[model samples]
Target: MPFTIDNTILLFSLLLFIGVFTTKFSARFGLPSLVFFIAVGMVLSKFIYYDNAALTQLFGIMALIVILFEGGLQTKWRNVREVMVPSLSLATLGVVLTTLVIGVSAKFILDVSWLEGMLFGAIVGSTDAAAVFAVLGNKNIKQRLTSTLEVESGTNDPMAVFLTVSFIQLIQSPNANIFTLILSFFWQMGLGLALGLLLGKIAVWCINKINLDSSGLYPVLAMAFAIFTYSSTSLLKGSGLLAVYMMALWVGNSDLTFRHSIFRFNEGFAWMMQILMFILLGLLVFPAELVQITWQGIALSVLLMFVARPIGVFISTMLMKFTAKEKALISWAGLRGAVPIVLATYPLLAGMENGHLFFNVVFFVVLSSALIQGATISPLAHALGLSQGKKSVVPHTLELVSMGKTNHEIVEVHVDEHSGADGKELRQLKMPQDSLVNAIIREQKMITPRGNTRLQAGDTLYVLARKGQNEEIKALFHQQVTEQDSANV
Candidate 1:
């Protein structure tokens, strides 16, 4: 068949369908589904010979915006806040340390120039959230450890991007001073954070005020807002990725109409984004080129997986008070993914010598990380005593909300020991009309509370109530004991 638009569409559809199927199959075998997605893309690229490299790159960029935004939305302030200092320090200083260590090691081991070594280090320094989240989700692990990893993955991208671009520019202009580089780094990250906050707030205000009849369209609008935030921030010489991610995190945790539906949509969207990013990255590779560089690539991948990562983790987490097991697990969990490959593209785009070699090397590193690190994550977690016991099977909760409707209600209720509802069946609580307990978190265990489930003291209940009735519901639940009732008692 001729390579036309129709043919391209059919090919993409087939790949996507097969990709989903392969992901399911991979999961059944206890392998990382992402590896399968990339494998599928590689197979297809060899067979079909798709020629739209530019389009693939564009799609990869778009996918990043979605992935980062979804990540942001899913992030909770409470979880991040608890580990803010350490997480931030790791993302910023730890990334710098990792890059320097790897760069210096690469210079000595691989005989590359300092700038080239730094580029290699920067490209591989940041952990990929897509890989980390996919592995960590639904796994039994301590909340603090999981949160620390999640927060690190989500926040560390900008630093990697900064270092990568900085080295790229330094290589291009060998005379650039250290002071100029430091100032530029500060400016980019600072501006990105500011723009993200501003844009996120505006988006939230717009979402709350706009009256849209179709609830399904709200997610699309939110996505547009996210993309716009990213683009505007990038245009202003800021880290658009950071801005969009921070904005999404803020908005996701905020009080917005159709909040549940938006989150649900974004979750699926993010997964799709991850799949597409990996596939595009896979397609960007030339199998012939990879074969030629295989040995060197393998060596660097090994150095990164074993030497660079462990040393960086050890030094960074030293004196941080994490248990020995926790520290070991943290060291093992630095799985690389699409970010390095994407960052590698910067050098290629800059027409730098050895750019293709760098890309292939980074690709091999990611593949190895996914294979070794991803495959053994659960086992390592278990060995390190970080695994949560056998998982409990709980039915998932589906939350649907109407958008642009101020009549909807969001309520928070804290369970107390003396409350009459404690230890009583959910059905017996006589909760206000049109109210449902969406989530009940007790001792850090998240439960989808059912009608027959008994409420426990110290549980945090997220109750979704009907609009205009929240005040009445709160009054009913928070009723004080009357003097007459005491006298009768």
Candidate 2:
């Protein structure tokens, strides 16, 4: 049936209502809301049919672009750098290893042809950042592990997609040369990276240069720009997913105006995309096909979870100086998600033989990974001794506003030992220029500083630093600590 305005509005309204309530319901039941979203989609599919596959596919792709961009925007460069080497290795080499392992195992054990087996492997190889981000957000996990998983998921899709598409091409055209395949892969990834960075920089310039009256609308404009970047890159034969993610990350980490509102908007939008994507995928599957694929799918999933994933993790982290426990956790945390199911649709759309089985198998794999890895993350962290009790809270940014002839600025800083103000007289430690020691809270007691007032360890001191001197003052304090640590050593 042709899509009518009423149908569009009604479907969207139902989706939004399901998205909101399922989140709360999932939380209450200790279940992943993605499961509920998929279930909802399945239920809707029975009653309301969309006869147009192209429209459904377009929606899925568009949703993925939005989801990837939002994930990129949330990625912190600081966090990415901490696990850069391992994360890169995991995303690239690990994906290759996983694909090869699953491919080989499927070909030999499941008696599938080489190309078909590899296709199956390639489809399931990439981890879903949307799933990982949704599950791990606001959860207390070790920074390094969390960062590694998040970074890997965020960056791995390009490589996985390249492999999947490359294999698909090879399967369709068996006469294609190896050199051609290699060149195409490099071209796609390189162009995608370049385009993403270029577009992101351009968008940043535009956002900062264009002074808009309504700050609230800036985020919406920014989101539109992000989508445009992805679409343009993909049209140019580049990886749209890669470009969108990189651009989002750049915008997110930059000093954009209305940063808080932008993040909030993206966060909600991302969740909505995820819910819609999972539901659409679930609706695409038939329960009978899912059952037929179950036995072999379960076998492949075991090989993926227990064999392929661990080997991939080992190869990626072997050179790194991680503890045994850390390695174990990393190996176990390779969670499959919506990406596999999405990729499975490709083969089915192409009318490949046994494509229904492929989709069903991919669905089962995603479910198993989410159920096992998602549930055990916290326990695994605790077992590895990587769970830092509660995250130490720190305020890193402060807002400043001004009125005629007076200015008010909020200051934020961390309480670290060896700070000049630590275990010493606040007066004795020379204050930076144009700064006032405003408030000090030590062990829940707010005390006003006097000339003889001594600062203690664990005291959070809020200083009213002068406008435009905040950076200099912070530098001075940090410099004092470096010198103190050197003296002690």
Candidate 3:
């Protein structure tokens, strides 16, 4: 069952089926699906002889883009706004601290050169998007806490990437000056930010202004532009990863036509990419090499879990208002995934002397993180009294979009069981100024809203509002919501 042309399609389909099917069982057992995905890859690895650093790196980049784009689409800008400073610090300073601690300690523990140790540190510094998504999907938590973690995991990859590449360059060119490296970092990030924002606005403009016969073409156009953002930014020595994410953030928060469809499509696609990347990385491994790095792997894993991760979380989030419990949960939630394995391939592709060792050590660290941290996140969140109960919602109406150009948005807002809109008259809801309630669909019938119309649960409001008042409208209905309220599930 090696990954080759013989029965290729059959093996591919089988892997996908098995991988997806295991998720249900994994969820039932409080096990993260990422761990299962890697396990599937590792099991298939026993039968395959696949190893190519360059090819793995290429596919890994594509997977990351798709994953990050999906993450951006779902991330609400409002949720991230209050947590921005802390998230930014976590993404940048947290990554640096983790790298330094792990790198410095690796020199003593793994007996590697300072450069090699830092390279290892840089590869595994940030929490993984896929890993976080999987574990957190099972738990119900406060929105602010969830938002902080999600934003950090989604955005930190770029900083981790910058450090890895910079350290690699330093290894290759020993005379690389500190000033040059610092300048390069700022240049890459600044240019990436400018380009991503510009492209996102341009993408929205094209989507709204351009009219194609088929609605499908709009999504195609958006996808093409997103790919262009990453590729073009990379060509200019900018952070393509950061650009893709920022582009996704802007487009996702915008009120675009057929956005619901696009969100669903990208989510499914991200999962597909995750499955392929994890299994492929798994299939690409040689068990003999993993065996050889056992003691070194254990030592490195302990240091990362105990020392590097806690320091990164506490110091980075010090200025923020996170409680001691929240910081503890954050530290314990930093699970690594396929990203580090993919990054480890960089050394191999660059012809570094310890590339093999780097890959093996990274594989061990990822395995340990997924098993240890992944297994404990839910229980730990509960112990810290941070886990909120999950609530299930049924979609009552489609987010309908009309044809032709329009600046106004028609949103279907759900009235929670105890939300202010639950019993208050329509006028008392205190919605944003200039907002209009087009119709209220109760029990499968439409009622034209009036000042005294009493709202209730299971009532779907067809409210018309200005394009930028989404958060405001949502606030009007969430009056009774507590701080422990989970996201709009």
The best candidate in terms of lDDT: 3
Task: Say what the RMSD of model 3 is.
Answer: 4.3
Name the lDDT of candidate 1. 0.78
TM-score of each: 0.85, 0.82, 0.88
Candidate 2, pairs of clashing residues? none
Structure candidate 1, residue pairs in collision: 72-249, 140-388
Candidate achieving the largest TM-score: 3
TM-score of 2: 0.82
Name the better of 1 and 3 by TM-score: 3
User: lDDT tens string, model 3, 401-457?
Assistant: 554345566667877675655777888766788878899888899988999999887
- Superposed model 1: Cα runs more than 4 Å off: 50-54, 390-403, 409-424, 427-489
- lDDT by candidate, in order shown: 0.78, 0.77, 0.82
> Which window of 10 residues has the lowest lDDT sum in candidate 2?
397-406
TM-score head-to-head 1 vs 2, winner: 1
Q: Residue 5 CA error for candidate 3 (Å)? A: 5.4
RMSD of each: 6.2, 4.9, 4.3
